[model samples]
Target: MGSDRTPIFLCAALLLLLVVGLFIPNWLVFLFTISMAKGLVVLGLILLMRTGLVSFGQGLYYCLGGYIVGISGQHWGITDVALVFLLVVLAATLLSSILGLLLCRYREIFFAMLTMAFSMILYGILVKSEKLGSTDGFIIAQATLFGWQPEVEASGTWIFALAVIITLVALLVMHLYFRSPMGFGGEAIRENEIRVEYLGVSPRRLIYIKYVVAAVLAAFGGAITAVAAGHVDPEMAFWATSGEFVFIALLGGTLHVAAPLVGAFLIEIIRTIALDLAPYTWQMILGGSLLLIIFFLPKGLWSLLPKRREEEGL
Candidate 1:
């Protein structure tokens, strides 16, 4: 019965988001779009966390996605939005597949550091390549859908709608993934890798697959964010950016697939408010809030939702 209601709840939430996009101010809609993009990256991080892993370098894929979009439009003259997205996914997947072969062998801090190292390497390369605009990055051309360019006023709305659709589809797919046998292996590996191996599952192989999936998700996020912002930069791959995704993942928790989306929204809203209220001390404010959440709601904001009646024995 509970399983039956899950789809209904997700559909309703998606509808609500669509309604919100229609009525919200343009600035707010743009902010929401950015949050949704970041949410995708956080979603990938949550996947890794479920398997007792954390990536400090998801920014690598995120940056690659944005750069591919920007570079393709500027240099390659690739104006088709659909094709750009496809290329980004393909590039991210190929790169991640190669890296995962090496990364999947390690665990814990080694994994985290190796991920960060790869991301930083990209950052350094971008910073040195003046042709790619160095550290300043470059603007992305306006995108078209089905050969139709949006009027200036409607562009934000169009991008917002696209972001929403992408997020909903990704969420539904990830929800299914979480219930699959491989997803079950994530938990088992997290709990006991040796036991999982004894049970005829290859923990390393599972981790590699999860890593690739996470990279692809982060790439999609970067692609969408570049389109919404009309800009791409090396900063997108910076360690601080990756840290923000990790923070969002922790803030949202891994209990539910939707947690990352909610958490990303909350964080973006809080950051906006904090910057307005205390521009100089906004970082301090954000840090304080995280400390509070960690102390009081260690399971993350998602856990605050009321349990179902069945769960409560009612």
Candidate 2:
């Protein structure tokens, strides 16, 4: 089980996926691409969740990231995927870094609501912009990668492979992070902020770092989603979108960095099946699934993995 987290295993898995994705149907590739993107957001959310904080406004960064990518591609003529992601990092870092200063002071429900409120602020602004299509939104320009333009016919496959590569990188970084002293700081803060500070560590500082990281991951997710979907709209920043990320976080469990990706793929599968079976009542289906998962596996789907059995009578 520990071997799975190693960089070698991750790279091998990505290569296998790239090979498989080349032959898969475009629709399947698109669905998985979006799932991988969302998994990135959930991975970020888990960072905050471990620190005993939740952001119902993660969609704020997600939306902002997509809009920035779309605007840059459409208006500024920046279509290279690599350059676009750099822009996303810059924007997300600037916004979240400033917000974290004030936001780190809050905890529990206050933190969640403040995040949501800020998210809605952006939502309201986008909804009012006339040229940006108001509620209608707009399509993004086709993206190229390192000057390699995938033909329109093969774009889905190209993006699927790209998403896989990106997701693998995020997973490896987070794997190392969750093992480091600083990564464990969030857990310490979550268990007892007072005790953590008694040890000379500043809880607020940790929360600030975690919050900023989470926001940036969310923006990265948003950027990927925008590229995969070829469109962006206000709905991406809605409370429901943020709620979905939280839902995915819970469904995946916080035990491992890869959990979010597994949870996202499961969600996409469930959502696709639900929409096919019950278009009008899909929410009920999802709600029911959530209840079942919560009741049956409170630790989330990651708990289903075989445990690393302790050394026998060592």
Candidate 3:
């Protein structure tokens, strides 16, 4: 029990820092919140990664989520943040249910390719449509907090709050999931599906459930992002955006729950610097770093450190 308390303490400390950040004046807090929101998306990817599956179509749900929020809040005049959140989750659930039927069947590169195709199709539609605001994408009117202002100066702060709350909730849920019997089943499916089948568990059903869970989480990330940015673009569904999520997952080393958040922040910081430092070569540098990480770490940046593995079991 003492050993298990470590990740809990780390998580608590992280939340504490996020709370403290709300009181600070730095614009970086906004970036931190953005990273956390994106982290939620990667957190969903973490589940699929753990299941030994890689999805490139997560942007499909993520983009859909942003569109849902944008269309609802802007076109339908839905201004309540809570209501938007609910709608995003419901939309993601339905989308994933439909996508899961087709996705849960394919494995390996085929699955990844199929997801990429679906994502591109969504991007194309968003780019070509004018009523959906085309590439221009509409700005969100102020979101009301139960019919009250949440303080204009603290708009970023409230976003950060939402990010932290969503992340903590997702982590708690995943923690329980990892400790459940189904978790063991998931690992079994990841390691050897045929063996799990002999044990009488339905791998397909389990994966489908995981698929929906991942989609909902990704959608939550996207909806929050749209609200925070006050805009939505077709670029949100681009292949590069999907690749960025994968990069974050790989950077953090994906061995533990905290890995994705760490990766998300690190990538954001690195990209921020790279964009400021060398606009033209930023992609080159990013690509180079990714290759190096892949070649040297293979398992990811977490594997390079000795602290977590020996003590945390990740």
Q: Top model by TM-score, which number?
A: 1
Q: How many residue pairs clash in all the candidates, one count each?
A: 0, 0, 0
Rank list by lDDT: 1, 2, 3
- Candidate 1 lDDT, tens digit per residue, 47-88? 999999999999999999999999999999886889999999
| Residue range 127-195, candidate 3, lDDT tens digits | 899988888877877777788767777787877787788888887787667656786677778899999
Candidate 2, clashing residue pairs? none
* Models, CA RMSD each: 2.0, 2.5, 2.1
Residue 226 lDDT in model 1? 96
Question: CA lDDT of 210 in candidate 3?
Answer: 88
Off by over 4 Å in 3: 1-3, 305-314
Q: Which residue pairs show backbone clashes in model 1?
A: none
Model 2: weakest 10-residue lDDT segment is 305-314
Model 3 C-alpha lDDT versus the unseen true structure: 0.82
Please tell me which model should have the higher TM-score, number 2 or number 3. 2
Model 3 TM-score on a 0 to 1 scale: 0.93
lDDT of 2 by residue, 61-176 (tens): 99989999999999999999999999999999999999999999999999999999999999999999988989999999999988888899888888888899888889889877
